[model samples]
Target: MANYINPMEPEIKYNIALLYFNEGRDEDAIKILKECIKLKDNIIKYHRTLGVVYLTNGKHDEGIKEVRTAFKLNENDILTLNNAGCYYAIYTNDLHRAYYNLKKAADGITSNTDEYTKNVIKKNYNDIKLVINKIEKGKPNDSIKVPDLRLLY
Candidate 1:
């Protein structure tokens, strides 16, 4: 096994976990991710991906916890900020926090930022801004719709 040959390579386990997540094997992914984290707790990707996996599996609190850990590890990471925004928007309906995260990510973009990541962050920020504007214009809370991230290829 690759892990047996390179037992210290947490990335190997992390990559396997990502593959399992893409295959919808959430429990398997979680198992390996936890192992990966135990091997190397400081990797932001491990925590971020684990957060996403937990959210997709409806483990809201655990997902938030992982994301919070990632944020603490690197608050300036645009990807983490964008994901935090989307996750809070979709799961917690905490528009304020979501908008803050997305705004930070959008503002942090530079020439080095890839087009796909820029578009995704901008789209999420604009979607949240629209909802906030609607609320500011006296729209009822019942009329507010959570932002959705779909078809962003």
Candidate 2:
């Protein structure tokens, strides 16, 4: 028989990856997400998902590269902005970029944004701001840790 394929298979794989991620199976999620990306390379969500999996698995560079590619593909995506902000803050320790991206995500929220999502974005924005304030005040003893919110997706 000839090879059979479903056009919706990529989405199925993406959903499966998400399920694995929620179960804390980062490795399995990474595998499925990679397959999904291979089948649908143009989809930003696939890249973003894979990036998040990599980051959570401690593959920092790979995660940043994937997320950066997604950002390049669609800078206006709030998820991309949030992921970039979290990645920069936690992994690269680039506070400026993290703040900028998180602020952009927060500012991008609109009427279409659900209340829960709006709260999450605002909370993250405020948390980053607090960290920035402490840093600026030369509070070297204060260490701020940004939460990895990617899994909440």
Candidate 3:
């Protein structure tokens, strides 16, 4: 196994964490992600995935912290922007921040981006736009229901 050969490799650990996460093993994913970060903190995916894991598990504070850290590591990364946008919108109720990030991400999409990714970003952007419109038209924020935030692999 790659992990067996490179036990200390951050990517290997990160991949393992992702596998655990996909398998619905949040605790195991978190543990491995933390270890991967300890092994190499600068890698953005480690923090991003960890943040997503935490957010999905209802650890809002921890998830937000990790997402912020990932942004600090690479603010221009489209995936980071998307994640932050969704996290801010869904968890923090910071529609302004969410709109900003989602807009940037949507605009930054290039030809290299896959169709699924473009669709995801567009959907998030549209959802945020709807929410913003409702608020501008004097709808109560709590009354407006936003859909789940989609994450990029």
Q: In terms of TM-score, which candidate is strongest?
A: 3
List per-prediction Cα lDDT, in the order shown: 0.84, 0.82, 0.89
| TM-scores of the models, in the order given | 0.88, 0.85, 0.90
Off by over 4 Å in 3: 1-4, 138-142
Q: Kindly report which residue stretches of model 1 are placed more than 4 angstroms away from their true locations once superposed.
A: 1-8, 150-153
Better of 1 and 2 by lDDT: 1
Q: Order the candidates by TM-score, highest first.
A: 3, 1, 2
lDDT of 1 by residue, 1-153 (tens): 353458567988887887888898999999999999998899888888888888877898998898889889998988888888888788878898889999999999999999988998999999999988888886464676676752111
What ranges in model 2 sit over 4 Å off? 1-8, 139-153
lDDT of 2 at 20: 94
TM-score of 1: 0.88
What TM-score does model 2 achieve against the real structure? 0.85
Query: How much is 1 displaced in model 2, in angstroms?
Result: 23
lDDT of 3 by residue, 6-124 (tens): 77888888889989999999999999999999988998988998998998999999998998899999988788899989988988899989999999999989999899989999999
